[model samples]
Target: MLHIRVITPASRTDEVLRIAADSPAVVNVLKLPGAAFDPEGDLVEFDVAREGANAVLADLKALGLKDTGGISVEQLDLSISTAAEAAEHAAPGDPEDAVVWEELSARTAAEARMTWSYFAFLALAVQIAAIGALLDQPILIVGAMVLGPDFGPVAAMCFGVLQRNVRLIGAAARTLAAGFAVAIAITLACAAVSRLIGWIEPTMLDDRPLTSFIIHPDRWSFVVAVLAGVAGILSMTARKSSALVGVFISVTTVPAAGNIAVAIALAHWNEVGASLVQLGVNLAGMIVAGIATLFIQRLMWSRLGRHDIAPHSPEVAAGQPTSGRVSG
Candidate 1:
């Protein structure tokens, strides 16, 4: 169930009210006239079952309520509602689910536009990579993978393609490229510093067999990438974020790339080339797997009709401004 707050101009209050009243999924409707100060509109509040949320929102949007006044859909914590029984009884079973490509695209773009912390995270990832190389430790390599923030943009790119949002695709791609460039540069610099201190020897690259994980290209690496991609996407859509830990372990991109940077800093040409190959293999595998996973999940959701999860109404909160558009 979702709580929808609809705010519409005085002239269109009647139409909005009628829509809510007639909606079978709406269990309670409350109206507060002359309550809106900014934008000066009436407020209409209602509760709708999750199954019918999409339909109700679409209908209200067609009425131009969102454009002229406002419509906001907020997910309610079901634990507090005293009318839980009534709400459950009124709730429709999962409806046919369809992929809202546009919504998914918007979501991807929004996530890509992360704050400066993203850069910091990248820097930390490079440092971890440097550490892994100096100590010749796979555990540190894995830690770097978990620390890398590269997954956000990668996931965003996959989502953008699924939704066919060019803007999202562009934004995600740009962020991803920029982040990696920075990480590689930092890792290279760290490698140089380690060499200067004699903490790491350039010749060690020729003998270190464990570092091969970064550059080894094979079928199994692709398989790992595909599996990681699926797990990453599922973590994003579902509420289980802890699953991403497993995803981090599955993909060798960050660790492999970091290893390559360290090898390059040490002037190990052979290792550098191999690490690059490993990075490429991991990337290709993840993208293919991510796209496939998204397609399958959408198909399943649409068949279940779980898309409708909010009411169509513009209710401007105390300080919240309505953008008048549905963002994924």
Candidate 2:
């Protein structure tokens, strides 16, 4: 379930109410007249099953409420009402499979921002991974994999492609490119320092049995990357975050970057080239698979025959209807 809070202008309150009334998936509706001080409008709040959120939100957007007032949505962790249960049952699809595009866009947009924290995490993850590669420690490699936050921009890039949002696509692409550059530079610097201190010798990177895969790209690597991309996209849309960690662990992106840093510091030029190839393979595979997954989801949602609401539709949601009630 999702909770929606809308601030609607006085003139459009009825239309807003009508959208709620027409949907069996909306429950526990509340209307507060003149309740919004900043926007100077009425406040309408309701809970809707996830399956109906996209349709309802699209309808609300068509009404131009976003320009005149505001709309906000949040996930409902627990709703004990019988009305909530009925609403969920009335919805056409399962809650777990629902995808609220607006919410997703907002999330990915924020993720695409190249913030200080993003660089910090990426740099630290790469540094840890570089050390792991030098020591041939599979455990540290896995730890760095879990710690990396590269999936955010990757998912954003995939979503941007799906929606054909050129601005979003550019922003996400830049973020990915700049993020890796920063992480690699930092990790390389760290490895160079370790080499100066005589802590790591060039031969330490030669027979890295546990971590050699990080620098080797094969068909299996691409296959695993594609599968990981699909699973990562699914886990996110389904809101199963725990599963996303497994997605992170299954990919070699961070590890490849780590291997590249160590190889450069140790002057193993051939290994550096191979590690670069491995990184490219993983990224290419993920982007291709992620774009396909999102396209499939959009197609499936469209097949349900509930998309944009027509601006000229006659159904004006006048006042409260029997479908919903205002709390006194």
Q: After TM-score superposition, what is the CA distance of residue 229 in candidate 1 from its true location, in Å?
A: 1.4
TM-score of 2: 0.93
Task: Report RMSD (Å) for each prediction in the order shown.
Answer: 6.1, 4.9
Candidate 1 RMSD computed on C-alpha atoms after optimal superposition onto the true structure: 6.1
lDDT of 1 by residue, 8-125 (tens): 8988888778766665667678899978777789998888655556556666666676568888776566635656445545544432233333234445666688558887887787
Evaluated at residue 124, the lDDT of candidate 1 is 83
**Candidate 1, backbone clash total:** 13
The TM-scores, one per candidate, come to 0.79, 0.93
Candidate 2's clash total is 2
| Lowest summed lDDT window (length 10), candidate 2 | 319-328
The local lDDT score (0 to 100) that residue 49 gets in candidate 1 is: 59
